[model samples]
Target: MITMSPASSNINSTDLDYYCTETPTVAIIWCVLGVLCACVGIPASVWLLWVLVQRQRSGTSNDIYVVNLTVMDLFYNVGTAPSMINYIAFRNHAFVLLDEILYSFSAIGRPLFMTCMCMDCFMAVVYPITYMKMKRYRYRLLSCAAVWGITPCIGTINAFIWYSPIPGALYWLLVPTIAICDLAILYTLRKPDPSGRSDVHPQKQRALQTITNSFVMTLVCYLPLMAMGPFLRLMPASDQVKFCVISLLVYIAPLLGGIIMPLLQLHSLGRLRGLLYCTRDSGSSEQPDQQL
Candidate 1:
């Protein structure tokens, strides 16, 4: 009679083989996309922030939310994009502390920023008149600062907990909570605008649509990784094939989302479209219109 330990019995030989042998085509794709994303996302995010800063001087509340989103995207691209490149090039090398730190920063920042964006949307929908009345620039600055300060602190604590012997219960809890919050924002938007406004402005509708798409994209990207966590925990020595599949699925979704978001925003926001055109027409001396 042959006896196998419970742990060995649970391990999938196929999963182990897959991870060891597969070339991680997904990672390669992610690397290419990551490089391209950095090239475009970084520059565009910076320019958007600059434009928002320019707008800020004139002092409008609406621009604050957009500016905050731009800053979030900027930081995300700057901090996270290089990690993808490193992972692709080095295959998860030991000397990737910078990549790890950037990855961790982004892991926290993305959700935090998304939550802030959702809150901004909720405020706009629920209190349109008040939202209009509020001095947006100060509120925007304060809100962004709070998010930046709070998320990193919480992330550091979570990282410590993660490294300890305790199970990663907090991560599981946080993921679901963030998902639920995003869903709530979508739900609130689905409700009729309380002002009995039958007609939605085209620009406003497009903005809302862009946000809705972004939320969906984020959920799609992260949910698989969340689901796979338990499987990984239970079968650490599982076969490489299953591991590769999960890794590819987990990474590709986010990479695709990161690529699509800026494009979606450009489609929705004419100002971004105009900026792109102006940049392309570098040598043209024609005066550009101030209004998007």
Candidate 2:
């Protein structure tokens, strides 16, 4: 939280020292609201994950990916969401740093895993046969392990760069990569079947549309958080303003992200939109292991 005192331009002009103090009444408002949001949002996400798992015991590839994303969101909100309160408490500096670590883990890990999820689904949609032959639980789990392990290391380094007040950009290069893959998958899915037998693959079209909707929602939610990167250092403002803005941004991104995924899982697929699962045979009760 940013301190709400009068603007301090006399302090080190290079660094705002954001997050070292709590903002005024607004900080209190945001903290209470953030805690309330987390309390309400986390359990809904849990129920959503359970719904995904119950819908398929062995779980489709998409189910696994969704479960992974839910876990990341839950961890983020539960672990780091209270940092707002901690900021208000103004306890030991060490505790503050610890929360930052937790924040970094969620922030870095979510996007890293999201990029993987997008790539995994893009492959499933754009090249189903090849993806199925190679997609196994072991391989998918390993990819998830890589994301969790790698992103935090990079995040720690970037955190240091920012804290050091170094002149640098904090963009996570994965954003554009994920966007391009999604656009490609969407294009490929919408392309006409050369054999003109599109009638046979109505299920594919529905799945692709649902997946596109998910990606578009995620992209929209991320813009508020990611758009702040370019201005992290360059955005000129009072220390109080910078702190308040950053604290709000840090929590707002997660609040939207944590809520959006479960909402997508539950509401994005209503009767009007068709079931999230698709089947080749009308009478078959079982669905294939891969989903968009």
Q: Using TM-score as the measure, which candidate wins?
A: 2
Judged by lDDT, which candidate is best? 2
| Full-model lDDT for every candidate | 0.54, 0.59
Whole-structure CA lDDT of model 1: 0.54
> For residues 188-254, what per-residue lDDT tens digits would candidate 1 score against the true structure?
5667768998887675676567567656755775665556556765654434534454455455554
What is candidate 2's local distance difference test score?
A: 0.59
| Candidate 2 residue lDDT tens string, 1-292 | 2111112111243554444444555556666766776776688678777776776775442556667777777776686455666666754455555555555545566666777777877878888898889846777799888867775565445434334321112234666767777888788877888998757376675567556755765576555556654565576776556666554644465555656666666664452234434443433544343432
Question: Which stretches of candidate 2 lie above 4 Å from their native place?
Answer: 1-26, 58-62, 154-172, 193-206, 246-251, 269-292
